[model samples]
Target: MKLSQLLEYDPIIVQCHDNPDADAIASGYAIYEYFKEHSKNVRFVYSGRNAIQKSNLLLLINYLKIGDVLEHIEEWKDDEFEGLVVTVDCQYGAGNVTRIPAKYVAIIDHHQKEIENVELSEIVSGLGSCSTLVWRMLREEGFDLDDIKINTALYFGLYTDTNSLSEINNPFDKDMRDMIAYEKSVIIILRNSNFSLDELEIAGNAMKNYLYYPKNRFAVIKAKQCDPNILGLISDFLLQVAEVDEAIVYNEWPGGFKYSVRTCVKEVHADELASFIAEGIGSGGGHIEKAGGFIRRDLYEAKFKDLDTEEFFRTRIDEYFDTFEVIYASEYEADISKMELYAKKKIHQGFVIAKDILPIGTPVIVRTLEGDIETEVSDDLVFMIGIKGEVYTNHREKFERSYQMTDIEYLSDDELLKPEYLPTVHSRNDGSVIDLSKHAHVCISSGATQICACQIDKRVKIFTKWYTETYMAGKPGDYLAVRTDDPHDVYIVERDIFFRTYEKME
Candidate 1:
């Protein structure tokens, strides 16, 4: 939708996320300016259990002159004032943001993951910062930027959200940075803003008591209680260690523990690690390089009862490595042609093939990402097969060089059956037939009534109806009788029948 279309709703309200940060405030303020310029009634609002508490965030709000413009959500009386609500920076109804009720709601955010119920949203992930998105929107609408305060706010929002432009990976973030002009001294001051006294003490103690895993270059620390931001700070500080490639810091709260993770290693994704730690315990996810999550205390206690928290975290890290191996090992690109063949019929493909059956003269297709080869089975082959049934003496060496047997999988007979294609029961009344041609031998239970066979003698048949008479193996009802021949060959094989036939011929 166009920018001007936002004014179609009366008394429009632009709302930022809970515990509003510089980015949220800046983005909401930008939207507020656009709607206000068009003479539409708009109010910038935020709602949370606590107001803006961080010193740097408070400073940014004052510096940007957003204190009067932004109001607490509780201050607005729904009965007195009602309009279309617009969520900025953070998505509406997300875990981080408090939900607000409105007749019609629109969302403008930069978070990658989104929830439903958003009818109008301009969400763009990987933009580094939501301020960049808002800045782009303001520019696209030809909004005047005579107010330097707005520019400074947007710049600060972009700077802090992307960690002083160090985390900016997209063109839009850089474009917004270059477009906005700001004083270098202000940026230096903002960057140098020190952590609180409590935060400093927490980080210091965490680093001093951290556990170092040299094999994976992972560092872990647990604290009794600390500010959530301190975990992130300590996690970053842990990466400064020469031997550390990844850092994890967690702190206990009422009924759960919040964790912050950071990784400089390209192969280790902090987001994935956070989720791994919280799997079956709690919720966790964030950026690739920096991520944080929470785990319920009950889950932690169940594993760490009568043990130290440090040892518990160490075990968790080991579990993470084990899970990582299993999850990441099979994440490589698959052969599209082999995948198509596997989908069409549950037979040999990329990693799966018939375990023991190598039908002579039948075409066998082996495929890998590099390419695929078609070969026909030959009778004389031993641990090697012909490309097209031709005798190749060096087949083993050639095949080994072309294919890695370790990567290919040989499947068993039980693995090839498609559940949907299998008959529920073998019966003529239901028009259902059981398939048995794939098996060399068949076993029938005494309780089984409806009988069907796919192979009769040396001929292959589709599900043909058959019958059998019950016979004891040893004693009465000792075991079910096994049939060797159904075409009366047993009588010919008897000694009496053979002797009588010979006598008649004589």
Candidate 2:
């Protein structure tokens, strides 16, 4: 429904999502500005005060004089207030907000669908930020923009929600362009806001506490009493760490635990991971690259209390990494000799032979549809095999066996193997099939492939015919270059080499 239609009633209650983020706060303020301009009485209400990372958000609140609403609310006699209630940046009765009475008039948000009993609801995931939607509404209603406070709040909302415009895509192009054009000053304000040394210290400490599982290509970090906004900051930091495909941070709060998961690999979505982890436990949801969820503190502590603090967090973090395994569309065992011949001929011609052919200690490059990634050779990578002609490193044993390459499809520039599509490979030695798909692609450093082979799961056997004969001076566990499918690149082997190397050469 149109804002005009919804605002036909006077004295409205404007509420944002609980723990109001920048987008929610900005959207709330923008709506308040729109209504106040039309000479309507609106009071903004929220549950759970904002935290430290969102302190800059308060600047907008003060600048826009949203403090006036709080003042009016103080004067309001509970019985004296009678008006339609409208919620922005949140669904009616969502976990993010307190339960509103049946009097909810309208809802505006950028989240997925939720059970909201409001009379009017507009939830669009297409919008990059909820504030963008609010901005559009104000413009549509011809609200004045001369109010610096309103503009500042909206700008901060847009900046924080979109990660400084990093999350926006073509779908939000127009909205982003307009926001950028109109709110240039607001952007400057956000940049100048004091993020505070304490916040940075907390984030750094969280990183230091991260536990990495080489076999899974994932990491996890846990802490007590951290700002929710720091979750986003942590995710961004972990993505840049070498060899980390995905990372998660679980923060303990007074009443519950919140989890934030981030991925540089395209195959997995953060929201899906959050949902998977939250299943049969608490609540969680988010987008593909970034997602979050919450678990009641009592339940979380009860289930994980016996586990070592580091171990518990790491185990939970590794659970979802198994889903990223690389699986072939079909299974087959091609002759190793034929594959070797192809690689040898290609290598002789100065074409980087894209094959599973690095020795335990040979350094190699790993290239995927998204981009090139690198890691050092470790003990658990022996069972991973690249496609006959394809090269990449991973920890799982499922991708080792020969597989038939049928249809070839291209993924987006940033797309990687999704966890669901990974195929499991059975080991020929013990009649046991290991799922190697979990470690679909990897890079390894030079001179560490041999030591890496010893770390493979006991059930899988490693074949080494495809390894290069050259040996450089380095320890067995030293990093090595592993070949990948891309003809122009090589990757550092991060785990076991036996699985990644196919024997047919020596």
Candidate 3:
């Protein structure tokens, strides 16, 4: 829901999850500011067993001067008041948030859905932080982020929640990190004040006690109840050990488990392994080398029942390694005996000429849902947008030979390719972001290119000749494919997409 919708009620009150963190405080403060701008009687307050005590949080509150409205209310006054009470960074009546009585209640959160009875609520889970969600909502209402305090609060909220932005996975989080302007001095102060002596002891103790699986050279350490960011620090330090190739650090929270994964090996991407470990139980993602995840206690108990948490992690890691076969296309040959020959079907896709939008030699970072890729704008470089809205680099010669230009114009969100976020290129020269769709045109597959493809029953990781550092993961039912003309050129096709875009030849 839009922030303006809550303006209808007077004397509106903003609430955050109990024991408010940086994200919670920032989110509520933003709402309070939005209402204050509208001249609405708004009060931002939080209630819990204790008031804010964290050093960095106190610094954030003092620096932003939010102490005036953002307060700790032992008991909410204005009994039987007819106004709206909005919860930010948390859902109303959830395990983390304290429920306050009001005539109308609304929730703005970026956590798993829990309170469904609230009609006026906005909850988009899987975001890096609630601050990004609030920032996006404020932007929708045309709220200016020029206020350095607001910018810093939002940035710090993201920074703290996502472990200094090393655990950020969503595009919205990255966009906020790049586009938003904040006071560096204030951020530095808050960041340095993050760890207390007790937390330092917790980190040190966690390191001394760890479960090591010698086979995979991975270490799992459980820190005593501490800040989630502490888990990241522990994992980062754990990965520096010469024998440890990957590290998993965790700390228990009231609601669930907070875990961080760090990996120095290319065989297992930290983000991918984190996601695999939390697959059906919770949400997890980040960068290749560093990532984090949250496992809901309810979901964990429901699935594993009485299983030890350590064993669960160990088994998951083992499954992650055992189920997948890593294939380097450059050194591998395909056997067609068990594979079937398939021809490409005529399908309209999006394409962007590399030189059309940027200078021929401009260095750029292409950002997509898949990941960010570094390349330079060149005459021979072409970007091919697949049916799933994924963008990939293609050679101009191959693009001409394998596809035909189409008259159909490309739109960011088409019925065929309903992409979550359209691809964009950020120039390293001047730090400008260019939407690839602006210079995009449609193309039709030639239907002459053929591949020997076979559905895979096991997990596969294919490092094609192009991307040596990153491998595309293929799960069961996905196709392992090789170009008919070049048996060594291997790749994977997702189950649904493979069937939709290819047909077996007679």
Task: Write down the TM-score of every candidate.
Answer: 0.59, 0.59, 0.78
Task: Estimate every model's Cα lDDT from 0 to 1.
Answer: 0.57, 0.54, 0.84
Best-fitting candidate, scored by TM-score: 3
Q: Write the per-residue lDDT of candidate 1 for residues 95-152, one digit (tens) a residue.
A: 4565667777888887655565676777765567788988888778788876777777
Instruction: Sort the candidates on TM-score, descending order.
Output: 3, 2, 1
Instruction: In model 2, state the lDDT of residue 348.
Output: 7
Question: Of the candidates numbered 2 and 3, which has the greater lDDT value?
Answer: 3
Q: Model 3, 353-383: lDDT tens per residue?
A: 8988888999887877666677888989998
For residues 66-139, what per-residue lDDT tens digits would candidate 2 score against the true structure?
56564212122345335777778878766656555634467888766665455577666546678778767666
Model 3 alpha-carbon drift over 4 Å, by segment: 1-24, 39-53, 65-148, 158-185, 253-256, 280-283, 286-289, 296-307, 412-415, 418-420
Q: How does candidate 1 score on lDDT?
A: 0.57
Which sections of candidate 2 miss by over 4 Å?
Answer: 49-53, 68-82, 116-119, 146-148, 179-186, 301-312, 321-506
Question: What CA RMSD would you report for each candidate?
Answer: 20.8, 15.8, 5.2
